[model samples]
Target: MIRKTSLIAVGVVAALGISLWGGSAMAQGDSYTIKFGNVISAGDTQNQGYALFADLVKERSDGRIKVQVYPDSQLGGEREMIEATQFGDIEMTAPSVGVLANFDKSLEVFDFPFIFEDAETAYKVLDSELGDEMLAGLQNSGLIALGWGENGFRNLAMVKGTVKTPDEMKGIKLRTMQVPMHIAYWRSIGAAPTPMPFPEVFTSLQQGVVDGVENPYELLYSAKFTEPAHYLTETRHIYDPEVILISKDFFEGLSAEDQKIIQGAADEMVAKIRSLKATISDEIRAKIVAAGGTVTDLTDAERQQWIDSAIPFYKENASKVDTEKLKAILEAAGNTTYLEAIQ
Candidate 1:
């Protein structure tokens, strides 16, 4: 009878242990390994922010979650990475809002040229209710949009000469991101816009396939595009914010605790990325000049001319997007002219 009782007690204890272990396993939900990808170099600000996110997730999750970052299109270009994330083939990507707009048409308003005066105004719009509403639309596209990251203001870098006035852009074969609004704006301004992937811009510039390219100073200097296209103009034509995205399906499968960690890290990343970008333009402009690229700035008059040139573009394309959201962004940016015109 003593032996029988002892065996029964052992079986009860074993069953209890198994139940506890299974509950714990279910709570953690099959340790997730996130594959994060981007098109920038490993040392770029975006990557720095992503690395921080990965570190925070690993430390906070007690090593249950592992994040691996693939920079410089190692996974693929922005569009491809986004698609991969949507299909659950990859885990995450930070794509320029322009690229993301192709998937969520509501985001297309962000691609409008000369819409934002500076990073501060851009941030105000993106951090407001309007931005959250736009981000919320991503659920339909299979992406869970995190907060916004910065691409900084895109400037013109040419192989031939500096472009100050809108007329100066005439007939220049400028390489543009494969975003329709961007292409349309350039075409309206009289430039022959050549749409291509980010990876192709540098070689196209070097080979004379495209006479010039436009991007943030950080990208131009980091990617060595300024080496081939020596004339850099501080056009500040567009304020592009990259949207940090993850697979909605994968995100939903995680425990609520893990979800909080991922979301918190993403918020931290936005702050880090914007802080870095806030001060990086001047630093990179100096680097470009030191590397023998000619850097030029527009006069106040020239800047106004650039702004005025976009009126026609805004008129034709503003109706293509959600006008109410566009108005909200304009109101947030204090773009009274465009806002009034649209209204």
Candidate 2:
């Protein structure tokens, strides 16, 4: 009887071992790798912020997941990358919200010329109910908007001359991202807004295909947009948003735990990127000045001129965008000027 009991116990232990091994195999099989790609140059604030995301995911997953980052347009421009993510060919991409608005016009509200006056105001709106509602629009486009990142306030840099006032921008050729509102805004102000990829701007400026490009101080320094466009204008005319977008298909495929892990990491990285940008404006503008390029800050009156000039633009393009959505944003601004929403 003792021998028979011992044999039964051994059989139970053997079954348990097989079950545990099968469970391990199942867990391994369920793991999926994600590729995170961006157009930003490596080591810039965007990439530094993105690194924080990668580290968080690895720590959270304990190595069950991997996020591979491809920077510097090694894959393609923001538009191309977004398409890749949509089709699930690539897992993720973050484009400046300007290009992203093309995929989902609801985001064009962010494209509103001079919508955000400061990052704090932007943060309040972006982190609030308004931002969440806007982000939800991405699901239909096959994108999961992870979190907001920073592109900061955009300033104009020109190869031709320093623009100290609205009049100075007249007849000047400027390069803008491929966004309609931005192009229209510049056109209204009498500057030719050329649309192209971030990578191609340097060559376009070098070849004199375009006279100027506009971006925040950080991008101007990192992308070397200032070298080709020697005159820097702190126009800050358009306040744009940069966003981190993950493929909805891939994100939805992950377990709920993994989904939270991926999103939580991006949330944490936004503050870091914003903090880094906050401290760099003066220093970056100074660096450009030290290099013998002219850096001009618009006077308060000059700044208002840029703002007032957008009135005609809004009248024309606001209808061109979704009127219902525009009403929501306008209502958010208290039915005042679009500038009120950001300020």
lDDT, candidates in the order shown:
0.84, 0.76
User: How do the residues 1-343 of candidate 2 rate in per-residue lDDT, one tens digit apiece?
Assistant: 0122322543454434322211332222256577888888896878888888888888888887778889999899999999999987888898988898888898887777666667777777777677777777777797778778888899888887777776677777788889988888888888878888888898899889998888888788888888888888887777778878877656555444565677778888887788888888888878887888788777898888887888777877776777667666556644377634323
| Shift in Å, residue 16, candidate 2 | 24
Model 2 steric clash pairs = none
lDDT of 1: 0.84
TM-score of 1: 0.91
Q: Give candidate 2 misplaced runs (Cα > 4 Å).
A: 1-29, 330-335, 339-343
Q: Candidates' TM-scores?
A: 0.91, 0.87
- C-alpha lDDT (0 to 100) for residue 172 of candidate 2: 78
Residue 56 displacement in candidate 2 (angstroms): 1.0
* Residue 323 miss distance in model 1 (angstroms): 1.5
The positional error of residue 178 in candidate 2, measured at the CA in angstroms, is 1.1
**Could you list the CA RMSD of all candidates, in the order they appear?**
9.6, 10.2
